[model samples]
Target: MMKINQHILDFAKVFIAINLCLVIYSFAFESMHWLLNTQVAFFSSLFITIASFLSYKRNIQSRISNLDMSKTSKTEDRDKIDEIDDPYDLYTEYEEIPEEELTPEKIKEIINDEKSKVRKDSFKNTLFSAGGFLSIYRVLGYGSLLFGFFALNNNGIFLPIAFMIGLGVVPLGVLASKLLFKKL
Candidate 1:
């Protein structure tokens, strides 16, 4: 899909840009240790962020699909209205459930139903689900980042400032990609 391709392109751009800088630094300053330190930190963080993004994207897509499947006659009416004033449906749609029919018990029932759904979708329950926050890949990503950081520090190869900079590469890459690829 286009989304997957875009992610790959962004990743490639970021990876190349950061490593290119490191390559030049290694040649000019002749400090391979700095390059190694930065690389480990950058890579581990990249793993974590990318895994998190994929999980989140999958979660959103599933929710959208569920919504699409549950469309009803009421929603169909709204679709006709949306074609008039708000052609794109850019504004939030209000429910047709009238205020007069909203009795105390009805409100309570609605609230309870929503609460139950929230409980079902809670982070703890979804931790290892397909689109979960703590899915296996994400857990591994976090583990790699944590262990990599500790290993670097324990071995006394920790260049504190450089390591921090390396950790920032992904975010910087995201920004750069957005700027460079923005549609006019």
Candidate 2:
């Protein structure tokens, strides 16, 4: 399952890379050159980069939100009476069972069971989310790099600007990876 997820994430990263390249090529050769000023190229590239990042964030948020446990809880009918009535009766019947009746061995067993469950759940979620964010960050980082290349190549007048933007991407990528790791 994790491998499959990683594969899917890899595909997404590649797709984003291709899309970014296309955007850069189009901006450099097709549309903005006719606009006269290099500002048009700069702003157009900036807008595309920002829009892509926003869309990526939106996609991640939407996916995570859909997977939220709160939504499942909200749809569940806790007020349903008859379904729980028998369990209530059984609990009442067992009410006389003393707390001291639970042996240390049984308590230890239950604690271990709960701990194992928690660990498994944590591992699964971490793996899945890490895969997701790894893919996302890769896409964003590479896309930004590609855009920087385009900006540098087409607008020699804005070379310093493009250089700074390109150089800035490295730290941004690191920060993003760190944050994503923490989240996972």
Candidate 3:
């Protein structure tokens, strides 16, 4: 059997639990419209969150695999827990160049190269990368949210409060999941 991802299982549990509560509320209130509106928003947000999560996970995996083995080995002696929690070190040491090599032209060239790299990395992270904000899945996700909201509202089936609650489900679920999964 193929192994299922634990994060996805957590999300599924969240989805089911929220909807089950809503179902009970719907039954008591006898308001199917509220249930429908909430479901649409909840499902759309959950879909988007899952897609972005998968994209981010893929990006991180690739980054890890592409890291220089020598650098990884140097950090291997540190606490294993810290490495697992944060693989990327936020502070990197800078190498110093001798004053003799710091000519105006050389300085200009170095600055330009750094600028270009920054621009390239920023552009890639903002749009071209799988986990970027403008990536296909993200775009689709927002589009679905907007269209779903308008569709339900236009049909006179929307409950603003219920829809808002539904939209909040993912963040709440994520928080709850983290708490549930936190290390002792």
What's each prediction's TM-score?
Answer: 0.68, 0.33, 0.68
lDDT of each: 0.75, 0.51, 0.78
- Per residue, candidate 3 scores C-alpha lDDT tens digits across 122-173 of 9766653545444577678888999999999898888899888888888887
The residue-by-residue lDDT of candidate 2 on 22-41, one tens digit each, is 45755776554332233333
Error of 1 at 174 (Å): 0.7
* Model 2 weakest 10-residue run by lDDT: 86-95
Candidates sorted on lDDT, descending = 3, 1, 2
Candidate 3 Cα errors over 4 Å, as ranges: 62-113, 124-131
Best of the candidates, lDDT: 3
Residue 2 of model 3, lDDT score: 97
Please give the distance, in angstroms, between residue 59's alpha carbon in candidate 1 and its true position after superposition: 1.4
- Superposing all C-alpha atoms, what RMSD in Å does each candidate have to the true structure? 4.9, 13.9, 5.0
Better of 2 and 3 by TM-score: 3
Q: Which 10-residue window of candidate 1 scores lowest in summed lDDT?
A: 68-77
| lDDT, residue 84, model 3 | 64
Q: What is the lDDT of residue 85 in candidate 1?
A: 65
* Stretches of model 1 off by over 4 angstroms after superposition: 1-7, 68-73, 79-130
Please give the lDDT score at residue 113 for candidate 1. Answer: 100
- In the predicted model 1, the residue pairs found to clash are none
